[model samples]
Target: MKGRAIAGIALILLGAYLFFMRDENISTGSVFAYFWPTLFVIPVGILLHWLYFGVFGRSAVGVLVPAGIVTTTGIVCQIATLTDGWSYLWPGFILAVAVGLFELYWFSGRNKALLIPINILAGASLIFFVAFSISNLLGKLALGQPFLAIVFILAGAFLLAARKSTP
Candidate 1:
């Protein structure tokens, strides 16, 4: 019953959107514009991986995870587009990357190098992204100065200003 209700609601909304927003200018290609990201998940992803595998074979198995992850990030970007949710959903891409790293680590015989970065990225995304999107952190960050950028600039400047200590 609940599922039917949700489906009904979706149908109604789609109907209203068609009635109010539809135009003769709308073509199949234009309709598919919103879903362009799916292309990356399919033809681009499959074709590139196929080509890579053809050239490198299992020796390049590690490429699979990151390629799949590019698709995942594209998927996340697609979702964010529908409602302009990038402000909150950007972390989701980071989380997706961490997930891809875990896949690599798992499938590539558990490389110790992947474990540290995976844990760090997953932890940072959970802590920072969740806090920014769900809690008071969003308000503060939005309202506050661009301190993060400033800090980055300052760090770069400091590096440039420093004298070489190597003797």
Candidate 2:
């Protein structure tokens, strides 16, 4: 995680990309040309938040939530840009918020202050997923909808099992 180590890894990745460009049909350079800002913005934001949290001993959910949001948004943007599916990526924002809220809820020792946002964001992500599916943004079988359904089912089952076993 040191600066020199990260720089070395980045250089190695770049070297690999350059070496693979001849065989690949896509242009990695072009992609980087367009998304360079995102490459820096996302990691730097997350790193800052993580450093801040580390200083606090990772006990602060507030920092963790924002960090997760920043990281997720960056990754979603990169994927959408690469795939040329900007419109289809709209749901990712909702998902990022939901993830951040969930992280806050789960890591903040289940603080009551984080509950409202967690529920709200999670609901919003579901709404967006359904909307995307009905609109066929990514096709009839939008991946998020099924994944969300499975997640919901699994979570519900787990909660039920936990409750039944609790006495």
Candidate 3:
């Protein structure tokens, strides 16, 4: 427990540093700057959570919880980026969520079937998120108006809620 706590704190501090200190040449301004650091912290958090469960809890759920948190965080950050016109870090965020869902399914014991629908939704969400991000980045498509972001958020929320409601 102590180790997990320490790692969590370290990850948070690292995220803070990245958010506050990283330099970007993208010219998107402060909003993009603010999000760049999260690109680093989200992955570190997932790794630390994996280590924590592998060493301490010895339970798959332990890893899943932290990984899920990391995924959710990425979703949140990407939403902010899209809505606020912040530099689109959507690719990183999508990758984080993908990894998180993979870890969740991979670590889940025999109840894997229970996560199927949730995984499907998460997968779809990832696809849309990535597509939207890519389109926006390439300047080939406009950012999804208000409704689209809400849809993604709500879908992510439903997946999370469903996971929580399950065993």
Question: What TM-score would every model get versus the actual structure?
Answer: 0.55, 0.57, 0.39
Better of 1 and 2 by lDDT: 2
- lDDT value for candidate 1? 0.68
| Candidate 3 runs further than 4 Å off | 1-40, 43-54, 71-101, 130-167
RMSD of each: 11.4, 9.8, 14.9
User: What value of lDDT does candidate 2 attain over all alpha carbons?
Assistant: 0.69
Question: Model 2 over residues 25-98: C-alpha lDDT tens digits?
Answer: 54767648546636675886568576656677555557877877887788777666655556666778877887
Between candidates 1 and 3, the one scoring higher on lDDT is 1
Q: What ranges in model 2 sit over 4 Å off?
A: 1-29, 58-60, 137-167
What are the lDDT figures for the candidates, one per model? 0.68, 0.69, 0.60
Ranking by TM-score: 2, 1, 3
| Residue 145 displacement in candidate 3 (angstroms) | 15
Q: Which ten residues in a row have the lowest lDDT in candidate 1?
A: 34-43
Worst 10 residues of 3 by lDDT: 85-94
- Per-residue lDDT tens digits for candidate 1, residues 20-106, read 445636566754554466544545655546654688766776776776667667767666655456777788777878877886787
- In candidate 2, residue 142 scores what lDDT? 65
Instruction: Evaluate model 3: give its lDDT.
Output: 0.60
